[model samples]
Target: MSNLTARLRASLVAALPPEQLLPDSQPEYVRSYVYVFGATTLASFGFLIISGIVLALFGPGWWHVSRIGHFFNSIHFWSVQAFFFFMVLHLWAQFFMAAWRGGRGITWLTGAVTFVVSLGAAFTGYLSQQNFDSQWIAVQGKDAMNAIGIGAYFNLLNFGQMYTYHVFLLPVAVAALTTVHLLQVRRRGVVPPIPPRGLGG
Candidate 1:
């Protein structure tokens, strides 16, 4: 047991050195408005999760009937909007900076996957709403799912299922993927800015 534990510790230390995992400082090039967007995106996502939890706890009906519930609902709604807005800005900035240049392809790929999955989460949230908008979205989503031959398994009209997906499964998946993406980013430090044309070899 002791030998096995030693091996595990060695492997972990080699894979993620303390300096890299918990850096005290970053490269000078890291100070830029573009880099700030990633932090903003994370902040928005944090609020989105908190607001979503409040909505889920009281059930969907409360949001439509009570003032407090409505307040939380509005927070959740606006947080979703802000999350995507910041995410898009972060994505564009990273793309322009070629963030995958320093062996960070997996980090970039995971972020992209998270965005795509978030769209599904948002779609399910719309369907789970007990309102006219939900009805319209369910009908439209059903047609789209049927066209893709996935309607049988993924019924947009099923409020319970959509709610389960939106409030539970999708959030878990997004959180897990986001964690991996962040770990990768830390493992392989941020990519540096491109050098000026005249300065290049």
Candidate 2:
């Protein structure tokens, strides 16, 4: 047992050194507004998760009928909006900075995957709302989903199924992908700014 534990520790250390896992400092270039957007995106996601949990605890129908529930619903709604807003800024900033330059392809890939999954989560949330908007979206989305042959397993018209997806499965996927993306970011450290070009020789 001791030998197995030692081997496991060694492997973990080899993959993620203490310095990389918990850095005390970062490069000076990391202070820029562009770099901050990534952190902002993460903060927004955290808030969205908290607000979503509150809504889930009270049940979906409460949000439509109770004053407190309505307030939490608004919070969840705006948090989703903020999450996407910050995420888009982060994506654009990383693209311009060429974040995948330092053999960080997996990091970029995970972030992109998280964004795509989050969109699916947002769509399911809309479907689970049990409101007129949800009805319209489901009616319209069914055609598109059918064209892709995915409507059979994923029925957008089913509120219970959509609620389960929005509150459980999709959130789990987004959280897992975000965790992996952050781990890769820590492993690689922040990407450096492009150096200024020299005057023509």
Candidate 3:
């Protein structure tokens, strides 16, 4: 039986006693290199959140000027890079595998939505840096935002607004969506591999 199916049938197998459920905690490590893209993206996101909390506690001045703050800033920045890197891999892998097969359409949908929200979070993050770079971004973006008819509301030039979005609103949205995505995965389990051509047919 597949590992996931066996695990899901735990209650039925519980009657088998300890001798049968060997290595219950240990996962199939051999699958990690190919199958762990989603997990790796999550790990990167964890680092992003922790490092972001540190940077937030210190405020803009400290992060832009202080040495220790610079260290954490680097961590947060690199974590974003890693998050996107593994997220793309996970997304594409799921796409090609048709992970929406079976009743997993919502699972795939949640993941796709999370990616779009993460983009907004990352964009606001660039604006929250509170430096010349941020000023340049605001100047360049404000006109576009106005042209698009949201500048009055969003006000990309407003540091406090962008900072609040980067620090609070968008992050919460991403986290909430990610949580729902995870719950869906747990509910339906991962999609199984496709059968070979003409094999299952």
Report lDDT per candidate.
Answer: 0.90, 0.91, 0.86
User: Roughly what TM-score does model 3 have, to 2 decimal places?
Assistant: 0.82
Residue 197, model 3: lDDT of 92
Per-residue lDDT tens digits for candidate 2, residues 21-78, read 9999998777678878888889888988998889889888998999999998899888
TM-score-best of 2 and 3: 2
Per-residue accuracy of model 1 over 90-191 as CA lDDT, tens digit each:
999999998998688999999999999999988898887799999999997798899988999998988989999999999899999998888889888889
Superior by lDDT: candidate 1 or candidate 2: 2
Clashing pairs in 2: none
Alpha carbon deviation, residue 2, candidate 2 (Å):
9.0
**Weakest 10 consecutive residues of candidate 1 by summed lDDT:** 192-201
- Whole-model alpha-carbon lDDT for candidate 3: 0.86
Clashes (N, CA, C under 3 Å) per candidate: 0, 0, 0
RMSD (Å) of each candidate, 1 decimal: 1.6, 2.2, 7.3
Residue 90 of model 3 has an lDDT of: 94
Cα error of candidate 3 at position 18, Å:
18
lDDT of 3 by residue, 24-68 (tens): 343333354546899999999999999999998988779767889
**Candidate 3: minimum summed lDDT over ten consecutive residues — where?**
21-30
